[model samples]
Target chain A: MKGMSIIVKKVAQLISGLIFLYGIYIITHGHLTPGGGFAGGAIIAGAYILNILAFGSDAMNLKNKEQGSSLSESLAIFIVLMLAVFALFIGSKIFFANYLPKGQLGEIISAGAIPLYNIFIGIEVAAAIITIFLALVIFKEEVKK
Target chain B: MNSLIPLFVIVPLATSFLIMILGKFINGFQKTITPLVLLFLTVLSFYCLLNNHSNSYTYAIGGWEPIDNIPIAIYFVMDGFSLILLCIISLIGFLASVYSISYIAKFTSENNFYSLLCLMITGMSGVVLSGDLFNLFVFLEISVISSYALVAFGTEKEELEASFKYQVLGGIASFIILFAIGLIYWRTKTLNIADISALFHSHETSTFDLFIQILLISGFGLKAAMMPFHAWLPDAHSSAPSPISAMLSGVLIKAVGIYVIIRLFFTMFIVSEEISLLITTLGTISMVIGVLLAIGQWDIKRLLAYHSISQMGYVVLSIGIGLVLLARGVKPTVATLAIAGGLFHMVNHAVFKGLLFLNAGAIEHRINTRNLKEMGGLSKHMPVTSGTSFIASMAISGIPPFNGFFSKLIIIIAAVQAKFYLVAFLAVFVSVITLASFLKFQRYAFYNKSEHRSTSKIKEVPFPMLFSMIVMGILCLAFSLLAFPGIREQILGPAIDVLTNPNQYVQTIIGI
Candidate 1:
């Protein structure tokens, strides 16, 4: 559970932030680009994993964070479900009909509700992966104990 | 009514996550909410079933309209076939959840159990109602993945090992199914089932078309636990906790397995003689072989698990007989009878088999043993468990006045009329063997004079558990009335109509 070498730790601290930013960028631009919720979410998880690997899970308070992440994951998915159900009541009353007014085609907000879906899904996926990573690490640490 | 179709998938999925999040703060929330949601679902499904005027309904997700007569939207269709499936899913699900209120108390993380059960129900409902192929595959994964986790819920060595085996086999099955879907998509350029059917009907089926059928049958057959691909059933079913065992045995295999096989063959693909015979042959082999294997099992759940395979064989066999007759364009009445028997037996099996598993759970709850040799004269101790199991056993063995007897009689009559003397004989033979097997189950578990266990501390299960078992036992007898023509036409009639006339299904979904 100890941290890695000073060099590796410093390098991860420097690069993980950049990776986190990149993941957010990917998630935000998901509607216009190739990477959406899943790919960007994996990237965000990678950044957290990198930090955990360098600083050690004990330093990261990952065991406690696992609970919060899972709860967040549940909440994100619930929001997604609510969004779908919300659409069931609007306008013509379709389950997943996009209710938001469409913006211009090339804009970030162009696709209306699609971007909102991607963001929530991204959050859910990132939280899910982080929770899974934290769980396996905690299990390993506990088993060692 | 049509707007409610997606809610079958939606309500369960939403409640599952709600349990996961809300169970953190709310005391006794999982227990109360789980049964309430299931009860609501059961009532909703019944309302849908009875209110329908022999018509099918479809809902397109996202309000996407078909373009140029091609359905591009993800569709949920509630035809007669899926309606029957929906009723049974919600019914057994309600009962199992009620049973879990008591049964799952012994386990830690009660929230996780309920949440996963809800998720599994969501998946099965989605599979039943999905009109498109890819969504069906997605929902199948949702249910089975939850099942793998649920089977290993106890995390005991044996339970974990069984779940692992199931996952490996299930992963392979999913891959085969996905590959088949990909091929179908490549050929028809559509994911809508009705669309694919219309396209396949337009073109004479080629050898490549038959290959996709093989892939689908083998993939779903693995899920169904037909003879060749049944290695996972006994271990998985036995190792899981009893209520889960009931759900897995009673409804999971039917929803994701036999139901899909029947739906796809009848509506998605054109009926082929070779494939029909193949299905019948597989069903018969599973019937005889599954029972042969069950007789030797010492574990109560394992024995019931094997019987599940055998009984499922009855369903598949009768349906396959109908398929064969339909392929030959012969006696429509015999085909209808065979299919009616299959559907009736399927519903009956859900009730009796579910009751049987609950009984096993109750027995295991008390004595901490599933071995027959380790049990004796439990009829005096656990009256409800013993009494209900008696009803289930008699029903399964085709004794008269039980639902099983009527269904088996219809299947045998259909086989006889179709001139399949050997099939009729095997149907009779399998029923006799089933009788012997259950008699062994009865003698050792309930009626044996020998005192194997101390038997001093045993008592009846809690009211919630017994309540579920009693209702299922009542259903076992109540369903026998379905054998009468008047009652039969009301329940099994629509499901039989859908299977017999695939063109109607295609036209309805495509709105041609």
Candidate 2:
């Protein structure tokens, strides 16, 4: 139930917000950048994981609380599915049709639906990683007890 | 018509996520929604199958048109062969879902089980429908991964152990398959199955092609649980929940393993006599070995699981017979018969094996034991389960008037006519052994007098479970109609044609 030293805790809190912001940067510019959803999502998950390690298990509960990580994970993927299904409803009904207009190449929103997909997938991946991490933590705790 | 293909994968996938989200707020949402979605899929698949009987239909995901006669799109093909598999996936999935409604009540995480089941369906649909090799691999993992979780749903000692073993073997299979696909992509510079076949033909046969072929056979062989690579079947199938065992036995192996082998070998690769011979040899060995293993099992579900391996052998062997004959370019009619019988047996196995497992589940539900020695004289208490299981056992044993007999009959006739007298004899011999084993199962589980446990207090499983078993029971008899010439031609004919003439597939897909 205890956490690490004060130095680690102070450093983790300092960098966590910066890491979260960087993850957003990577996800938002996924159309023009190398990192996209999966990589960016991993980095964001790393931020949360760092905070959890520095703070204790009780600092944040990640599964099945009020709109917890598990629920958010499910909700995120459901929205992504709806977006894909949205493509079918709009056009001659293609399942993954990029129905929206393309702004321009190399822009933040160039690819019509790719950025949107990347953002949602990033959320899903991030939430999913934390959820799995928290589950292992709880299991380890229960085993110790 | 082709456009509807994506819905098969999409609807189940969406339903899976939808279940987890709404299951938190709504009571019984997972139970109600899962069966209805699968039912909708079953109707959709049959409708599409009848509408486009002869020709293959292709859909380009994202509507990406072919670039200068080269396919740049992620393609999905729905021909007669895949359509048959689609029907199997949805039909079995629906029945399993309905059965799970009652059966899964004991499990605390009911929502997780249903979600995983739907995801499994989505993956199988994508596997059969996809026209790209890499895409199929992705879908294969999706389904198998879901199965790994489902098998471990109980989280008990045996269940965890079985899932671990299944995962290790399954991981190796996926690695081998992905390596093969990587080779295909490297060699042909395309992932489209139709284009790969077309490109393969334009070039002379090389050792590289043979290497990839061997890799694919071994890789998918592991997935199919062929003779040599079948250690995972009994443990994984027996340890899992009954509905999952039914799905894994009935649909998962066929759609992900045998169906892919049939599709890739028939349509995607030029027929090689030696490879086909190897396949047939594997089939025969698995047939004898699987049944031999089954006869000694005390656990009813484990016994049924071993029988799955044996029955799959019939399918692989017959398909191999067709492949060898086609490569030899002689007696096309006989090869057609062999394949027709194979495909027919696959369908019959799905129905009857699924029913048998459900019966085993029902028995286990009433009495807390799967060991046949622990059970006795339950025929009076659970008439529906015992009666249906009798039909299932008789059908699987190839008795007359059941669908299994007809399919096995066709396979043996074709084998004999093709001058493979040994195959014909072994096949018949195996059927007799299967009969003995099932009879033993019936005797001990239902008719035998047991001194150990009193059976007076045991009640039948609830309605939902019985309903699924009864429907599958009727299907065991009803599918015998498929053995008739008129109906056989209508149902099995197109599937046979697809395998016989591979060029039609490439032509249809590539617009040659």
Q: Count clashes in each candidate, considering only residues at least 3 apart in sequence or on different chains.
A: 0, 0
lDDT of 2 at B495: 83
lDDT of candidate 1 over B1-512, digit per residue (tens): 99889889999999999999999999999999989999999999989988878468989899988888888899999988899999999999999999999888988999999999999999999999999999999999999999999999999999999999999999999999999999999998999999999999999999999999999999999999999999999999999989899999999999999999999999989879999999999999999999999999889999999999999999999999999999999999999989998999999999999999999999999889988998998999998889999999999999988999999999999999988899899999999999999999999999886466578777888999999999999999999998999978877888888898898888887883
lDDT of 2 by residue, A1-145 (tens): 7788999999999999999999999988888978888889989999999998898887665445424888899999999999988988886588788998988888776889899999999999998898888888888878999
lDDT of 2 by residue, B1-512 (tens): 87788999999999999999999899999999999999999999889877765568888888888878888889998888898999999999999999999999999989999999999999999999999998999999999999999999999999999999999999999999999999999999999999999999898878999999999999999999999999999999999999999999999999999999999999888868998999999999999999999999999999999999999999999999999999999999999999999999999999999999999999999898999999989999999999999999999999989999999999999999889999999999999999999999999999988778888898889999999999999999999999999988777778888888889988877883
Please report how far candidate 2 places residue B68 from its true position, in Å.
Answer: 0.7
Return the DockQ of model 2: 0.83
Cand. 1 Cα-lDDT: 0.93
Interface RMSD of 1: 0.5
Q: What is the C-alpha lDDT of each candidate?
A: 0.93, 0.93
Worst 10 residues of 1 chain A by lDDT: A55-64
Misplaced by over 4 Å in model 1 are none
Each candidate's DockQ score against the native complex? 0.96, 0.83
Interface RMSD (Å) of candidate 2: 0.9
